[model samples]
Target chain A: MTAALHALLWIAVTIGLYGAADWLYRKSGHRAFAHPVLLPVVVLIVIFEASNLDSAKYLASTQVFSTFLAAAVVGLAVPLYRSFDALKENRVAVMVAIMGGSVSGVISALIPAWLLHAPEGLIASLLTKSITTPIAVTVAQSVGGIPAVAAAVVIVTGLVAALIGPSVLRLVGVDDPVATGVALGTAGHAIGTAEAVRRSDVMGSVAAFAMIVNGLATAVLLPLIAAVVG
Target chain B: MIKTLAGIGFLVLLLYAVDGIKQALGLPVPSAIVAMLLLTFFFASQRRVPDFVDQGAKALMRVIPLLFIPPLVAILDVRAMVLSHPVVLFLAVTGSTLVGLVVTGLLYKALVRKRGRV
Candidate 1:
């Protein structure tokens, strides 16, 4: 296939997979098994391996979709903007919660890997397990971790959060929307925020605040902690 | 159409501008995040984002999940290596998430309750 056609084909595959997953998710009444993001990743991997397609070429062809990811991250500003008043109202609580959460996220991820005798690279990658992919990947690279491992860990961490977060919050009696949103955003990052948005716009916006605050805290705090430990 | 495009362009430019400043200052934070902070401050001060920008951003939210697939699929190349230490890695990752979530939730809930009682 020509270069343009190849790229178009990959784009088509991506959109098709996403659409199919969405359809399945709705059909399944939003079960995690039919998750749009998770399902596409699994199916795409199977497709690439089954066809024996060149992975690099496949990545190159689908580069456009990734650009949108960056834009989407920036696009999060709108929700944050919309939530400004709620954020201002609960500024002190939100800030304190995010700070505590970010520190706990880093420590929790690292201490386990340390105890389990995970490799140094894995340790570093786990440090970013709670942040969003783009920021986590950058932090991982800066701290001498494997970026891909960090990204995968981030996705898995998010999946866990998306699946377990709400129930866990309920079980723990974290009923306040602000607290619940902050916890989801802090632990789950983008995916958790997406779930929060599904729950309510206010929760979603608060979750966005939590996500950004957590990202910033992690981005700065991880490197500092890495330096101190080293 | 032009206004929407301009709004998007403005947002994208803000993203790059933050990135540029990050590189110049040698800051550790990610560009998108810094851009997000900048936008937050902008909205806090300006009191509103442009109408077109708001529309464009809301549109992006609808498809945000699609953004994750490429990165997740990219994990395919490293599956063998990551899966090699499957037991320790899985437990570590999942355990950390659960711990992180519960700890954060409880902490936030405590603070909220404290403030409420006051």
Candidate 2:
């Protein structure tokens, strides 16, 4: 394919795919589990891989989709900016929740591995499981873990949060938008935030900041695990 | 504009010593994840951190799906990628996720319930 044609084709597919995803999320009443970000990509990954399509071929055809991703994420700042007032007001509580959530999240993942007698490598990679993919992958690799396994775990972790989080929150009778967003964002990342936005702008906003906070906590905490596990 | 630059700058710094650090530490890490956590913490402590960097980070955060696609796609026959011990691995992953979700959920509530969010 000509470079122009390749770019055009990729852009068209990405936009088309994302459009379908956006519609799905909107259709889902903005639930975290209904996030368009990962689901469509998973489907696309399935198709591309099954068809034996090279990533370079897919990239040549799909680079345009990144524009969509950029727009979506940047657009998130709108809610993030708007909720600054709420975030500022509850900054202290959010901080504590983030730290607690981070430790709890890592422990949650690792404790299971220990119970299952999962290797030290699996446990170490998962210690950063709830964080974003890039971070998760790197953390997984750092502790003599597997990046691919970490990636899968990160996806599943986020997916589980997106799928069942709200219902759980409701079950607990917690309707506080701040808690909802922070919890989802801390545990789920972009997908959670999308769901958070659906729940409430404040939740989504808190979720965004929570993501940052959790990342910070993970960075500081994981190295310590290396010390303690020693 | 500024945010884009900040994000780009963030990426550069992230890519710089993280690989070396990971290698030097000879840790079992995937260098990128460690770098992300470090950046996140560093950004966390600064007074309100740079909104530019935040803006930049937010953009990167958005298309996170894309990052995931490449790898999952690379796996080709993922079912077969299970490396002959698929059940064990799947259990390890799924088990960890369930534990992570339920525990983290309860812990967050427990930690801050007494604080009474504002």
Candidate 3:
């Protein structure tokens, strides 16, 4: 096949696989482990390994999707704007909570990896684990980290938050819906917001609000911190 | 359809502008983020999201996860780096997430209690 045809073929395969994965994710009632992003990636990795296809070529073939990802990130302004009123009502409290969560999230990830002496690239990737995937990937690349690793770490962190974040919050006496939502959103990003939505409308809205704010804040903050510290 | 297209076109224009600004100012922030902030500011100033932008944003948001797949799939290449210190990786991700959740929750609660209905 010509290079163009080859790229087209892989792109089709990726979208088809993602379609199937998303169908399964919805059918499974949006379970954290059954996340739409997970299955297709696993399947693609397996296909790549089994066929001995170069992962770089696959990435290149699907570069259009990455562009869309950037567009989607920019599109996030709509939701952020919609959520502004909710955030405005508790401006100071919400801002402080998000800042605290974002800062601690970065510090906690960094200190552990730093103490373990992970490579600089790995440390940078870990820096954005708590943010949503799109922003995390961008921040990671800016800070000299691997975008793929940063995306993976963000997914894992979201999974962890979806699984036990609420329980942990409850154990610590965080029962209010707003607090629960803020905690989950701040720490979990989109995945945590999913779980929070299942709990209550207030939790859901607040979680969504927090998720966006946290992502925006971290995207701007982490890179600056990386520059300052370096 | 035209409205959606216009919205998307406008967003692309904003992205280009943000990129130019980033380059000129040597800002470390991502252009996409700057676009987001600019869009937010625009909507805030207008006190309403235009129909075209809202349509465009919703259309994009619906398939956002699909957009993430290609990059997420690239993880295969970095598996070795990720798995190198599995224990530390696990600790860093999970521990920080939990700590972040609790800290945000507690702080919000404390602040709300102090100020009343915040």
* Best candidate according to TM-score: 1
The local lDDT score (0 to 100) that residue A212 gets in candidate 2 is 58
| TM-score per candidate, chains pooled | 0.91, 0.67, 0.81
Please give, for residues A1-230, the per-residue lDDT of candidate 2 as tens digits: 78788768665665567668768878988665556655666677767657766666766465544343333443444455555666775566677766666666666555555766766766665676677665566556656776766676666667667677777766766556777777787777655666676556577778867765676567666767787876
Where model 2 places Cα greater than 4 Å from the true spot, the runs are: A2-4, A24-39, A59-84, A88-92, A115-120, A227-230, B1-118
Q: Which is the leading candidate under lDDT?
A: 3
Residue pairs with backbone overlap in model 1: none
Model 1 lDDT tens row, A5-26: 9999888988898999999999
CA deviation > 4 Å runs, candidate 3 = A132-148, A158-177, A188-230, B1-10, B20-27
lDDT for position A90 in model 1: 62
Fnat, model by model in order, equals 0.60, 0.15, 0.77
lDDT of 3 by residue, B1-118 (tens): 9998887777777787888888999976678866887888898899999999977766665665666677667767778987797876898779989999999999999999998774
Minimum summed lDDT over a 10-residue window in model 1 chain A is located at A64-73
Tens-digit lDDT track for model 2 on B11-90? Answer: 54555567678788886654544454555455445525566665665555555554344444444433443464454455
